[model samples]
Structures are given as C-alpha cells and as structure tokens.
Target: MFIDVVPNRGSPPAVLLRESYRDENGRTQKRTLANLSKLPGDVIEMLKALLNGGALIGTAPKDLAIERSLPHGHVAAVLGTIRKISLDRLILSTAKDAASRRFCDLVVAMMVDRLITPRSKLGFVRAVDEETAATSLGNLLRLGKVKDHEPYEALDWLLERQERIENGLARRHLKDGILVLYDVSSSYFEGHCCPLAQFGHSRDHRSDRLQIVYGLLCTRDGLPIAIEVFEGNAADPTTLKSQVDKLKARFGIKRVVLIGDRGMITSARIRDDLKTSSLDWITCLRAPQIQALAQGDGPLQLSLFDERDLAEISSPDFPGERLIMCRNRDLAMERARKREALLKATERELARVQANVRRKGSTLRSAAEIGLAVGEVVNAKKVAKHFALDIRDGHFSWSRKIEQIAAEAKLDGIYVIRTSVPKGELSAQNAVQAYKDLSRVERAFRSLKTVDLEIRPIRHWNANRVRAHVFLCMLAYHVEWHLRQRLAPLLFHDTELDRGRAARISPVASTEPSASARSKKAIKRNANGDPVHSFAGLIDHLGTMTRNIMRMPQAKKHPFTLLSKSTPLQDQAFKLLDLDPMRVQ
Candidate 1:
C-alpha cells in the first residue's frame, strides 16, 4: 500500500518509505527508503557553489564544527544603508546558485578590505579556511550562473539596466560634458586551460602567462564609468573602434570626445569609426616631418608660441591639432631644484672621496666611475675626522668636481611640445598642458593596480565569469573615484604627505598626498631626500571609521529600541549615500 507523502506547496519532494516489496515469481519481501527529498539548504549551498566557480578542491575550507558546517559563519558589516542585515539575508534575494553566491560575497568583501589595508600587510592567503570561504563565495557564484567568473550574467545584468542608467546619466550626470577616454588592456592569470584565459601580450611583460582582454572607459575627471570584456589576445587599436562604436549606440552621450594614446590614431580606423557617428577625437601626434615653410615661420604659422607657449598647426589628416605649450612655475622651480640637488650630490661625493683618501694616507685619486683624477691639489688642510671617511687632498678633488657640477647645471630650464592643432584655435603652450593631462590615465591605471582593483594573475577557469569579475571591479572603480573627486574639497591634497605623514605633518599643509590622491602613488625618487608616502597607511586610516558596541542600559527603553553613537565618517557616508542612519529599515 502507498501513503501520501507531505502535501505542501513549497515543501521539497518527500523521502519515500517502502513498506514491502515482493518479487513476481518467488516469495520474497523487502523494504527500503526511496526517493530522497531536496538536499538540505547548507548541503545544497555547497554543491551549487562548486558548480558555479569556487576553487575548493585545491583549498581547505575554514575549520568549522563538523556537526553544523551548513550555514557559513560571519560577514563583516559595511557602511551606510546595508549594515544591520545578516550577510545571508542580504544575499538571499537573488542567488541562482546558493553556493556561488556565498563565495562571491566573501571574496567581494575581502577585495574591498584589502584595498583599504596597507600593502605591506597584504598577503595571498588572509582567509581562515578554504571550505568556509567556499560557502560565503557560493552565493556570488550562484547569481553569476555561468560557472566560475562568467561575464554573461554581469553583461545581461548591465544590458537590462542600461535604460535606467543611461536615463539617469543623461538627466543628472555628465554636467561637465562627457570626455570619454576609451582603451583596451588585458589582465593575466595563471590558469591557461580556462577558455577565457587566452594568450595575450602582457602589459606588465607577463606574456609568459595566459591573458584576456579588458576594455575601460573613463571620465575626464579620472572616474571609470564602464568596463567590458573582449576575447583574449584582442588588438588594442581594433578594441578602440568597437568600444567607441558600442558606447555611441548604447548610451545617451552628449558632447562626447574620444581620447586615446598615439597607438590608436590610425587614419583608416578613424574614417571607419567616424562614418558610424559624428564623434570627435583627440590624439597625440608623432612629430610630423618638417617643411622649410614651417621651418621659417612661413604664412599659416602657429599663432600662440613662446619660450613657454602653445601654437596650433593645421594638418590634412586630422583636425583639432591644436598645439599648446604651457609653463608651470612650480615645474620650473622643480627643475632648478633638481639641478641644484644634482650639483650638491656630486659635490658631496667629491668631498667624501677626498676625505677617504686622506684618512687612508693614500695619494690623490680619479673620479670614482671615470677613474680620472681630473683635478689638482693646489692646497692642503687637515680637519679632525672621527668617522670612517678622512679629509685629505682637498684641492685636486675640488676643482674637477666643481667643473663637473657646473657642466651639469648648465643644461637647465628647457622643454618643448609640437602638435597638429589648427594655428588659430590653440597655442603650443595650451596644447602641451592638454597633453600633460594624459597623466590622468596613468593615475587611473594606478588605481586599477593598487587602490580599488587587482587585475593580475587571473584565476577564473571559465570564460564568462572572468569578464564579469572585471566588470564589477570597474563598477567599484567608478564609485570610489567619484567619491574621491567629491571628497577632495573637504580633504586637501598634500603634495608629499600621506596618512602616516599627516599625523606628523599639518593636516592642512599643501605638500602631502591626502586621502583623495591616495589611490595613486605621488612620490618618485627626488633628490630632496624627503620621506616616502604610503597609500596603504592612508587607506587604513581613512577607511577605519571607529565604532563602539555598547550594551543597552536598564531603562524604560525597550531592548529593540536601543541606539548607537554617531561616527563622523558613518554620518558622512550615510549622507553621501542618501541613507537614513536612524531608521535602518
């Protein structure tokens, strides 16, 4: 006889109990459990994650009590509107694959936290266990749907919301008009068998590894607006045309101009892309072959040119070839300072060597590298020398070093620029300034490298998910970059200082790198011997908004009615997000 299993709309198929089973010919009876029901949420969560794209076999899961490893443990809360909700609940809404979703969430959080952590403290393995990680990440994997690191889901998601985002941008954003810098770069990862991971030229010279294509779009303000994935090993010049064409078709862009490096300015490609839309482009020119007419400043000569000036020159192949030259007093001072520093450095070396020879009681010597004793010791003096270096043969060393320093200082106060811009529209000086803005792209790359994203050693085994991961990073980049621009006025830029330096230096001092510029490394080796700044320190300080967990006091207020104290950053982030901190719901 058969009995009805549980009858419920959402209940899983019931496990069947066989009362008795008899063979047709012989007299035999058997009983067994049949038709097992849906796998438990926790177990299913695991299975789904593995299928989606979590690397569990190679990794060890977190040490969980073997008894109840089902529900994963602990998700750190973020700022603004989404903090109070449990990690699982917040993630529960749309995970198609339970396992992948959990895994994705953890990884995303880890990525963010890493960005805000000091690089010196960064390591490959920060998570406790592989299995535990698998669980948290499963949720993201599930929603992603297409297997480990698929971009299809992300692409579909973006396409679905295209109308809304475009409308919002058209109406409210792009106030400064859209200056789109379109380019393609590739990210490399170790997994070669991955269909997505194909051979490509590595920007970091890691062609030894497999790579995939990535497209980036940025605002003139250095904000990343969108990221797309192309086939691995795609050409940069060709990647340019497609992205430019696609953006025009999909978005409501007003006054869009394409800015690209010299590599992308192909005449044939330009004609093809222009035929598709009426977009303007600005590109750097390789020096054009000079004409005797241009040589003598014949008619049609560039109008705005000076010792420090910008002048536009007309070119048949391109338009808006405005040449500009500009002088920044600060840059000029830096030039002088650097030359003086070099002289001082050479002079110091000469003195040190002279002292060393005297202490050793050795004869006069030549230049350290040149091996030429290019000076004469016309005078001799002995100064008390306690250190390892000695004072001797003063004159012979002095004359040659002085000559060398003078030669070095003589070549100062000069630089130049050339452009194809029309003579009347722009000057050589202004054109040079515009070209200098190309540094913005470098700043953008630094963010992609250290601050908001990590695009190297791609580990995704699947084709689509790799793309999706990159796309999401671009999204985060957009958010954080815009936040930086907004926060700049509030926090001033310190040319030479970072958070650590800020603690020692005045907060308002104009010589340090502040939180806004923390995304990029501002200091290079300068002869001044100033302290180096750290991005890691700035991120740790700024991102760490302090909070105190308190027990509600015994009072008329209900336990559920308790409130927490306000944090300055929390309040600021809340206001920026347009969230109500008091009413979390």
Candidate 2:
C-alpha cells in the first residue's frame, strides 16, 4: 500500500492510501484503502511510522538535534575507481611484511585524498578525522584507526620501494618501439636545509629560492611511467644519461625511441652515450644549430620553408641522421609580435638613458657613468645583437640593426628535429608528431605543479621525506591520468577517428569578444547534446551525493547511516567510470 496525492480542478488535492491487488482476470487494480487527509494528524504520523518500518517517529525539539555532513560521494567514486584499476592489489604485492602492507594501504588512502581534496599531511590527518566519509576508506582497507604520523611513516616506507614500484608500473604500461617522452621540471623549496634543494636553473622562475629537479618519463600517449629526482643544481643535458640508463637497465625497456626537448640532451650526448648503447633518440636542434643550418650554403636553407612547411634534409653536422624541419606560420607571427614589442620597450628605455646623459647642467658628467647607463640599457633587453648604440661627448646615437633583424626574420617559425630512427620505422611526419607529443610531458608537469597535484613548496626538510613527497605526487598523477582517460567523454580529450588520426574535440576558437567569452564557449558536450564538464566540475557534481547519519529524537539509542541517492547526472558520471553508486557506501 502507498499514499498517493491526486490533483483537482479547484479544490484541495486528494490524498489517498491505496493498495494494489490482482483480479481474477489477471489485471492489476488499485483499491482505495483510506482517505489520508480525513484522518487526524496523529493517526497520519502513526501510519507514516508504520510504513517506514518504525524508523520514522513523531517530531521532537529541533533545537537540540545535531547534524553533521562530510564529503563522501567524490571520494567514494575515486576510491571505487582505484580499486577497479587493481592499484591496491599492486601496492599490496610490493609489500614484503604485514606492517609494510598496512603502510601501503595508508599510502593508497593518501593518494585517494590527494585526488579528491589535496592537502598537506597534517591537513590530511585532520580531514580523515573530521570527515566520516574518509573513515570509510579505513573500512575499505580493513585497517584499524589510522594514527596521525602513519601517513608520514608510509611515505618513508614508500621511498624505500620506489624503484620496485616504478618498475612494476613501467612493465604494466610501457612496451618496446613506443615513443617515450621525457622532460625535467623544478619545484621550489621553502627551506635551504634539504640536501637535494640547491640553487640552480629554477623552472618555476623562483631564482631566489632553492629548488630540486625531477624528470618525468611517459609513453607516447602521455601516461606517466616513472619519475626520477636529481640534485637541485643538476643541468638539463646532464640528466639525460641517467634517465636513458634507467630506461634500459632499471625498466628493462629496449628499442624505444626517446624524445626530449633540444635543451634536455645535446647532440654530443646523442652521438656518444646514446650511440654507444645502440639506442634511438629524437630531439630538436637549438637555435644556434638551426641558424647554422639556415645561414650557410647547406642543404637546409631559408628557401626550404617558403615552398613547404615541412621537409626532410641531411646535414654534415649530424651525419647519418635525418633532419626534419617544420615551420609554423602562427608561431612566426607570434614571435614577430613579441620581438617587436620588446624592441619598442627597449627603445623607450634607451631614450630615457640618452636624455639623462645629455641633460643640461647635470652632475652626471663622467664618461664611466654614461658608459654604464648605455651598457645597462643594452644588456637589459638582451637584444644587443639587434641594436647599434654608442655614447660620445655627452650625446648618444642608436639605430636598429636592420640586416640582423632581417636575418632573424627569415628563420622565424622554423625549427629542426634530429632523429636516428629510420624513416621506415617512423616517418618524418610521425617523427614531427612524436616530438610535438612532448607537450604531453609539459602538461603532466603543469598538472603536477599547479593543476591536480600541488607538488611544490617543499614542506619536508628531510631529503628522503622530500623525495617521498614528490613520489606521492607522481603516484597521484598516475591515478589522475587514468581518471582523465576514462572520463574523457566529459573532458576535453583528443579523440582518434576511424582514419587513424587524432582530433581535438574542442578546437581553438578563432575569434572571441573577450577572454571570458572564449572560456564560456570552450565547454564540450556529449552525444546527448548535453554540456559535458571538466574534470573538476565532474568531481563537484559527484560530491553532491552525500552520506547522511540520522538520529531520531524518539529513537535516541539508534542512529542510522544512509547514502544519499544520486541524481541523474551523478548516476551518468558513475556509469562513465563504471562505478556503482550503491557500492560507494
């Protein structure tokens, strides 16, 4: 039996308690049991209580009741996906002892929290205590109450097994003949105590702050395979050999084409270290090398870009290697614009310095001072090569180096890539595509530093702890990569068509009224023509599903917990991730 509300034309809606019965004709029929509106309020309350298995009760004082809610749905969704990926089992297999296994679970919990809500170690502990939904993680792991220091302890343990863990991941996701992308990025440190934190090239642009360098290795599809940490003072070129050794010796990968930026591994290292090991590599040439190829009467000339945007050539500089040159018209325009802006700004500053030197009745009469002022303006722009300036007899003269500017303009938007991999193994276009895939590593670094996992502002002063901190961030990214792939329908992911070509679902808008307008227009939609959400927005939508613990005033001894039902959108998201909303509890 159920209570039903019926509408009327001009009177109060009728409320009837009805029961369904099967007639002898095998047809279902509903019979009116009672007019619920005609019953007294107390009798209606009793009926509701009876219908709810006696769990519902008459109202009591609302002021004395306490209610608490925690973020459950998003965390559960992430945890469920983690379990489906067998991450827990993989971590458990790495453990040699019971304590290590428990620590592994703690690490897994930390990763899940990192995905849902990134927090510091102390903040994580507080979240675990305050959010009852987080305690559900403990239930999933079948562990007792977690101590405050266990997360840090787990980090320490995880550091010891870093090699084994990364090796396991590489074996699972990586294979030979794959184009492996490599890139290095630095995360700044808050303190100077960490041994790994040294003053070097700061990729974060925090030159005043010390930092440690870390290299991320990933497959062609941008799935991160392993991460290596080096001293803060390490140079980019110097870090490549160690990574190549790691890929060959530690990860046991063979016949893989390593791809990196021009600054990462130099031509010298490629000719020596890589050649000695019989390994293949693909990387771009530095500006000087490109200039050398274009300036001289070599096979690669400025006329090459005039006919076509891409061409393959041979160079004496890199014998027996294919040089694939690419020219992007958009890049040319952008570079020209930036160069002109810098030149105009530099001219303005130079004019100010010239006026200061030539001012009448000025005390700045020394030639040394005038020379210093001229040197400052010239060196500040770093465009001294494109300008001719001189100071003489309290007067200054400056002119743009027209010939030099024209020479640079010819090479604009042109870059050369050197690869040892045969054209049959990988064509020039595919080689260019492979090098372009380096953006994936850049994206991974962006996600690590600023987006998903905030792997910066080193909080741990101990070197091992610092390593573990970064390692934890890498592990979180591992999960993030999978999440992005599985949730691609709702995200702006590259889709591969039937013709074996990749296409971006959301193409760059050619024009927009404003930046905000472009952002608003960037939203993607699913096949249903409904607007899809970004990864963050999708997580927030899932977070709306909550777990509630209710305590009735009449039933003081019984407090029951129930997971809130998912809305249609939330259910759809769960379906995309292959997670059952009912199993979230």
Residues 1-585, candidate 1, lDDT per residue (tens digit)?
A: 232245557866554434556688767675655543555657545554664675443234432112212111111112221232122232233546855454544444433433443121123122223333322223322333223233234334444443444334333444323556666677677776777677777776776887887767666656565666776777777777666655576565644666676666555556777435666566654322222224455422433323322233454433444422223445556766865555455556657655655565455543342234322211111111111222233333343345534433332222233343444554343344444445566676667755556655566676655655565455445444544543332332333433444363221112334443453334432223222224333233333332222223332243222223444543443454454533432
The candidate that wins on TM-score is 2
Best by lDDT: 2
Which pairs clash inside model 2? none
Q: TM-score for candidate 1, please give it.
A: 0.50
Report the Cα lDDT for residue 109, model 1. 44
Candidate 1 lDDT at 63 equals 20
Q: What C-alpha lDDT values do all the predictions have? A: 0.45, 0.78
